[model samples]
Each structure stands twice: as C-alpha cells, then as structure tokens.
Target: MRRVLAALAAGAFLVTASACGSSGDSTGSDKASSSGGTTKVKVGVIPIVDVAPLYLGQEKGFFKKQGLELEVSLAQGGAAIVPAVASGQYQFGFSNSTSLMIAQSNNVPVKVVSNGIASTGVQGKDFGALTVKGDSSIKSADQVEGKKVAINTLKNINETAVRESVRKAGGDPDKVKFVELAFDQMPAALDSGQIDAAMVVEPALATVKSQGAREIASPLVDVAPDLTVAMYFTSTSYEQRNAAVVKRFQAAVAESLAYADAHPDEARQIVTTYTKIPAAVLAKVTLPAWPAEPDRASLDALQKLGQDDGLFKTAPDLDKLLP
Candidate 1:
C-alpha cells in the first residue's frame, strides 16, 4: 500500500506558492434562492491540481447557478477533513477516499457526494510517481525495505499506496521507516541522502525526476484501478437537510468537471489563483479526469483496503455514507 497524505496538523494551511489573489465574492445575494433556498457550504481543499474541477466551479460561477454559496477553506489534508465535514464545520469538501473510508468505518456520518479525479491510464496525467535519488542504490520497491522513506504524512494516501506497492514488490512494508516531510523538503532530503525515497505528486514529482531521482513506481489509476484519488463530500446530516442543495451542487460540480476536461489550459490557469505552482509547472503536470458520478468500486476498494490494512478498527456501512 502507498502512503496516504491525509493527516491534519497545526500548520496545515501552508501558503500556496502561486496564489494570485482571493477569488472575488461569488454570492448571488440579490437573486432569489433556488428550490431549497440559500445554502452555504464551506468546502475544504488542498491547493493542488487534483481538485481542479472545484476551482473551476468557483471561478466559473457553477456554485452560484446551484444557489450555493461556496466558501473554499484551506484544509490541512484529507485526514482531518473528515472531522471538519462530519461535525458540520465544513458543509462540503474535497478529500481522498481512504480517509473517508476509515471515517465512515468509525461512524463519522459522511458520504462521497461526487467523484473528482479518476485514473485514465495517463502517466503524470492521472497519477503520481515515486522517486529515489538517482545515484542511490535503491531502484525498486523491494529495495525500500529497512530504509527510511519520506511521505507527506503517515496513514494518508501516499503511505497507503507505497506500502501496497512495496508488498507487491516483495518487500515487507513494516520494515521500512517512515518520516513525514513537506513536498518542498523532499528534494533537499534526497540531496542530503536523509531519506531513501519520497512518494511525490506533480509538479514536485517532475521536479524530483529532473533532479535525477530514479523512478521507482507510478501510483494512480494503474496502481489502484478502482481507487478514487480525488472526491467531493459532505456530511450525512447536511445532505439530509439540504438534499436539493446537494444535488444542485453536484450538478454544478459535474459541469465544472466537464468544462475542465474541455479546457485544460483554463483549468490550469484557475488553479493558479490558489496554488503556488507557476504556469510552466502546470504545463508539464498531467491532470486527472473529473468523473460525473462517484466510483462505487473505488469506494469499496478503499473500504476493504482500510480494513485489511488496519487503517481503521471498524468498517462503517459505506452504503449509508453515499449521497
């Protein structure tokens, strides 16, 4: 399983490298509310390409059409986002399926309302890669055993996938030492030989590769075919009380996803508002697909993987969590 980057910490909302400016106010206060009335959803998201559809929704006014007032919040990561949504701190948010699976198992009362990014068999397009220092002796997952590895966080998406990949390569994942490091620190760590390898996503993945880190594996749709790398979510209570709102929100998001698919350059440009990556970085990084519907199989995979991997002690009724 690969390491999952879904944990939260105090300094979680690190400033995006390329945040151009705050998204101007998107509220349609003067217009009459839709069927369910004015609904405000504080959506938690990381400043990355995975959730590009969401940024498009905000930029293109899809939320407004749905009569939704979306306040996109900076989240630590997917791990902490479950609590934020489950407790109603965030009306909706984006997250990896792994944390949601474990949270559902723990009775967090959440559901994957919509799908975000699915693998399309495109390298650097729908998935990320793992890299080790080029000069280092480590070359494959099997060699990672008993070595120190750096991941964005423990028990998150990156960690989960790395463990699975390592095991698949005949390495005992438990034998590897894990360290939590930010994306920016990975190159330095590798340069200093402080960590044996790091599981990175673009543009960091590309950056490391350019620096001469040998490719170990690529985990995206290929690694976990049924796994949903990106997802949109809300609490069960919120969905129940605002069923119509949720549906409208879903429709808006679906539109945003379609638009992003058609206009990749514009999609990349919008992300510049929230991320630090330059246009050059976005150009090289591959963007994943924004599926119209949730991947039940992916959710199921995450649930089974979480339970089998002991990511959570109890498995929640995933059926109840789906909106």
Candidate 2:
C-alpha cells in the first residue's frame, strides 16, 4: 500500500502516485480487437477489498452485458495504471482517489466513472489499521511520536489516513519517521523492533495481529466518515468515445454492486478465486459496502487531501474526473 510502482498483489500490494515512462497519449484505445460489436478492454486491478465490486461485476457478467470483453490484469501500482490506461494497454483501472488526484495534476485523461466502496461506520472496519507489536510499549497514537512508522506506500491512502488518524488522536504526525515496507513484512518488522507502528490493510491486518501485533487504531472508516476509499476510473477519452458502452457497463455494475452488498459471503467467495489469500483469512477480513454510485463530496475531499499533502499541485477538475 510501499509507495512503489510495482508490487505483489495480495502480499505487499503497493499503490503509489509515481509516474511510469511509457509512450502514449492520454487517449485510450483498446489494444486487442473484438469480433463484431464486442469491445475488448484491458482493465488494471489490484487484489484488495476495494476492488471487490469489480469481482462482482465480472462474476455477474456485467462487462458482457455492456458488450465489453474485459481482460482484467493486476497493476504494479496505481502509478503504473495512468500509462497503462492512457496507452490503451488498459481501457480502465481500479485505483483509489489518492493516486487519481496525483495523476490529474500531470494532465492524465482519466475520470472516476463509478464508486467502488465507501467507508460506512463499522462496515469498513477491516479496510485499514495501524498496528504495533503486541508486546511493544506503544499502546496508543501518542506513543508513536518520534517513533518509526511503516506504511505500504508513502503519500498514498495508507499514510494519509494514518497521518489524519494520528492528528485526531492528539499526536504530531510530523514527529514520526516514515518508512516504506510491504504489507507482509510489517509483522516481522514490528516483532524485530524495526518499526513502532505500521499502517496495513486486509488479511495482513489480521495476519499481523495473529503475529502478536495490536491495533492501536484504524482509519478505515473512523478517520473520515463515508469516505470514497475505492473507485473504478477510465480515461476521459474512453468515456467520451464509448459513451453508450460506458453507460451499459455502469448500469450492470450497479446491479452487481447491490447484489454483492446483499450477499457478502457470496461476493467473498468469488473474490477468492482470483486472489492468493486463503478463504479462512478472507472470511474474517472486513469487506466494504459496494456503493452503486460515486459520492461527490467524498471524492472532492480526497482530491483536496491530495492538494493539501502536496501530492497535487492544483485542484483537479471534478467535472472531468467523476461520472
């Protein structure tokens, strides 16, 4: 979540805002040809709870309903996706607003067409957490001051949310030293006393605790109420050129999202088919509520946070970014 462009999917799952030097325009074009009216699209994804709705969409044949023959691929990170989507290597990408805002500053022709998940009270409890070794002296956010903190990625969702959480708990986030590490390495790092706290997500949150890490606090839904934690984004050009196709996909996705929200266990089962995480770990993992539509205010706040964090130089034009 290590601030690197490339990473393992379910293990360390990093998503940074860094750029990838790939030749291409912001206009998206499908690399693979589709027979007749079928439009084949390459979609970049990451195996995480945020992407559950996409699994639901594919399982329910939402893409097929839209005449989109989608080939989903795991992205190295959120940064690699801009070029992948822009070069037509991928028609769309699954990313959080943290990377989206950063890409917008670079004039990336991408727009979040739909919402994936929003932090709704306890519903998104397992979305993210800050942890310390169970035997460590640190028991609260205040103990993290002047301490070493690890995050999967810097200046992205994990760190930003952790920073806000620390501030909310009357701690100076600036006083802590930040380091980038994989999600899986957190438990070992904490046990080795290499880091005082680590911001992690999913099975790793549960895994870290099982390794004797205690949760000091979690920012999943507590830091920002109903925040748009995940979304499906496509290049603006793709949306413009394939208006009817996009609408069809959106409609079908809306249906699948509602279905997944109603039948979470079924949704989780479908996700396990593609992800490397075990079913037992997945069973206890906190899944998010699949929202049917993107929240305008939550998205705006995310973009604002990017600007505030200096991840973006200018405010992104939401009209061009959102559906």
What TM-score against the true fold does each predicted structure earn?
0.83, 0.83
Best by lDDT: 1
Q: Which candidate is the best by TM-score?
A: 2
Name the runs in model 2 displaced over 4 angstroms.
1-32, 184-188, 191-194
| lDDT (Cα, tens digit) per residue for candidate 1, span 1-323 | 01122233223323211221342332412121334565666677765677777888878888888788776766436765665566555677787777677666656667788877776655434446667999989888878898888887577677777887787778888898888876657877887899989887655665676677877876554345645676888877777787787888889888989999889888767767876666666676666666676677766765666566778767767677665
- Off-target runs (Cα >4 Å) in candidate 1 are 1-38, 122-126
| Candidate 2 local lDDT, 255-285, one digit each (tens) | 7788889988887777677656666677677
Question: Residue 200 in model 1: shift from native, Å?
Answer: 1.6
Worst 10-residue lDDT window for candidate 2 reads 1-10
How does residue 305 of candidate 2 score in lDDT? Answer: 57
Root-mean-square deviation of every model: 5.8, 5.3
Report the C-alpha displacement of residue 188, candidate 2, in angstroms: 4.4
